[model samples]
Target: MNLKIQKISILLFLFSGLSVFSQIKEEQLILDKKREPEVKKIEKKKTSVESIKNYPPEEKSQNPVEYSITNVPALSDFQTSTLQADDISPNLKTDYYSNYVRFGMGNYGKILGDANVSYTLENKLEVGADAHINANHGLQNIYAWDSRQTSLKAGAFLNGYGEKGKYNVTADFGQENYNYYGIYALNPASDVDINQKVNAFRVKGSYDHFSNEYLNNITFKSSFLSDRFGAKENKGALDFNFSKHDLELPLNDVKMNADLGLGLETQSTDFEILNTNSSSYFLGNLSPKVTFIKDKSYLTIGSGFTYLSTNESNLSLDRKANKTYWFPKAELQLAKSDELKFYAGVDGGLSLNSYASMLEKNLYIVSDQRVTPTETKYNVYLGIRGDVDELIKYDVSIGHSKVNDILFYQTNNLFDTSIAAIRNAYDFANTFSAIYDNGTKNEVNASLQYFPRENFNVSGSFHYINYKMENFDNIYNVPTFSAELGAEYTLLNKKLLLGFKGFMASTMVTNLYDVTNTGLSTNYTTTEQLNTKFGGYVDFNLSAEYKIHKNFSIFAIGNNLIGGNYSTLQGYQVLGAQILGGLKVSF
Candidate 1:
């Protein structure tokens, strides 16, 4: 009985402990449920603050430190730095044409034609061909005088460039026909027909090494000329030039340049006459020069050594000569600014003379004539040139020159008078011969230009010369004073162009021969000299052009508008007022 009672008490105690543990767990679960919503609310508030800090501002301020609308670039409007096609201005660009043609006819039976075409390759090589024609039947007032002329020329050229230099080659052929009509106007009683024809062929080539340190340039040329009078001439020349620029000099702020050149020329002429005379000439020249340049000034010191040899079969003469000439060049800018500048220089050179060239200058020259080259010993000049303002500019210069073997035109009186036809023709033909003289000349020249507007420009020049001949009493056929004035105007957006030109010259002296019977015989005659003076006159011309399209245009030109009859040569009277119209096309 005592053991049962003890077991019951132990059971009661165990039950009480289990009930207390259950109460504690239930209270803890209720507290956890109530705090869950508070933790979620704190997480939502933290997310809101982070979003506000990440967003950008809406505007930027003028002050760099502050944000405002002015400082921010608009995202909707964007531009690139490169130029767009739409931004190019058409008026500042010019269109190029690879082919061109021009044709014209005028009063006095004048006709003209010209054409040119060119092609360029991918390698920068270019090739081109061109042709031209000009002919005139006769003047209206001159009746049978028939001042007719025709000239035709055709040429082709090839040009290319390389990494170091450029090169070009050209070939050409030409023909010219002219008639001597001045005799009829000078002597009405004489009747004669004089026709002259010239044919020429030429080839030329040049290579320039602009970047080469040693070899600079080279040139070669060959030409052949023939006339109807059984005269032929062939000429060839070769030239080379070497230069060094920016050479080291002893002085500071000063640069030096040196150049060396060599040239050789050969010419041969044949005249088909009774004697079959032939002449040959060989010439060589070596030139060396050094130049020094500083601020606003330069000085060039040079010397030319020449060797000349000539052989004439008919005269049985073989002549050889050598000469050396020293020429110094200098220029100084008297003013510090470009608006006003004064400069001076001394220069001289040798001039070549040939039958073909002489014939072109004076067609009346005898077919078989003697000729010699001219030498310009020295020329000294001083000049001032500058712009007075944006609208005006002026240049004036004074110079003195000493020359040897200067050519002059004079009439010949050495023809036979036994035959009536020969005498009459020779006496009245008024043909000219070339003569040489040594002399000194003084000259003054002045030029002025005005550009008052963008589309208009006017220019005028005046020249005065004084000649002192050592062997002759006076210099023949040379004008002492001359002047020219020209003006150009553009209108209608450059579609129409107008031009005016005027020229004036002073009087000149010419010689005339008077025939007299010396009572010796009918075949014999005496000639008396009569020095005549020709008064100079002024000439005016006008020209206009209108463009109908970019590729086509029409032009009209009027010559000698003032109608002042004048003679530029001894017995040649110039044409009166004449008009010409033409069309120009390009593609």
Candidate 2:
């Protein structure tokens, strides 16, 4: 296939997808309004009355008619609410938080802030904040994916609040600090370090109104997020309904309903490597979704068409022309009783002659390297659960996914020749995930959970992956595993408590019939062998609330009892057992 022909084909498909995006409905401008009278009344009631007081005899006798029922609309059949929360035993809860400050031999140090704090303000709004700072002196895997390299992520996430129908607003901001020794696949043996940071923010507002039918109530939501990883995402949506349950339609012996929504989104990403810089994206999208619901049984179908394009900015390759991409999505669900549920979904999309990495030329890649600019995908899933009523519960699930013309990154030392190759070796040498000329890559995953009580629980999940790489033998199957357990118990008349939790994982690559490109890949696939790595820690915390008198108490806490060494990633070390004890006084 000629390079010119490939470029033209990809351009045509991208343009066609963009045309669909142009038809998306424009967003309606919103005008902020002053708090309404009812909002003011609610605010006043909170501070004016100590509690609900009985109507005085004099006022009750004179305003008897004011309290009549004619002012309020009769409740309808569609009015309902369903609130389900993840259930964890005492052991699981303890382990979940304790895992943050793990303990073990050969561990770097520790990271801080596994717990959180939130505050409530006027107008039904709440503010939340959480922060973590990890600074280890040497190579640690405190937060690294493989626990091999050393790095740090100093960040915080803030949240503000308001509801769809509530007359309120909420927002938050966050930032992360990164200082690492090497980009995962690069000279892991080298001491050269890199520093980076990321910042993000989100805000929302909603208004409420009384309604008689399902279509009268309206709610609008919008949010924007930006990440330093060279990605910026923004999306806004509007949801209007009379009853939240209008989507629940009546079908046979079950209750049923459906909801329809339209939305638009845009995203941009920039990859920064030694010698290459490129941007690939689905800039704008028009999406629509509809859901059908019945008692413990339901199905949902959704689809979106996006105007996608890729921009390659590298000194070595001719700038790839911009092209459009189209992606369609769908999902289905089935559930029988509280203990059993199953679901499946699929998303199909495409990419044009996109850049392979920060350094490489877009014009000189093989059929696999330069996607036809046309692509498709498929996905499926199944799940089951048991014993919802007992203290003990169990769950299992599986999922499979496949994609065509999927983009990938690679690095090659032997292939370097020109200055560009040496400078951008990690970028250009990296191979993209394999794509069959016929178009596709596949993956399978499964997981299980067990809980015997609210205080303790355990779970394990794993995945098996296989891919066909471009220009090389089919890649080997890779298997990954994760397991965790923990518990929490209270003493001192439920005033004092202790909690602990831990987890471990293992990764293996099998059937690697070909090793030619092993070194060209990220993370340097060395040792065509079995690698065994595992770590766990038990965190013991003591918290107490002592009542000095009525309506008041003093609270104190001690953290990280065992000084565990745990690394979330390969080289980032967590902290050693250091304690921060503090007291809070209430009146």
After superposing candidate 2, which stretches have Cα over 4 Å from the reference?
1-119, 127-132, 140-178, 182-251, 254-256, 269-276, 280-282, 287-289, 316-336, 342-376, 390-394, 405-451, 468-479, 486-492, 495-500, 508-587
TM-score of candidate 1 against the unseen true structure: 0.77
Model 1 weakest 10-residue run by lDDT = 27-36
lDDT of 2 by residue, 22-106 (tens): 3321111111111111111011111122211122223212122222111111110010000000111111112111112211112
Q: What is the lDDT of residue 465 in candidate 2?
A: 51
Model 2 collision count = 65
Off by over 4 Å in 1: 1-94, 184-191, 248-250, 273-278, 313-335, 387-394, 421-428, 515-521, 524-530
Q: Best-fitting candidate, measured by TM-score?
A: 1
Error of 1 at 477 (Å): 1.6
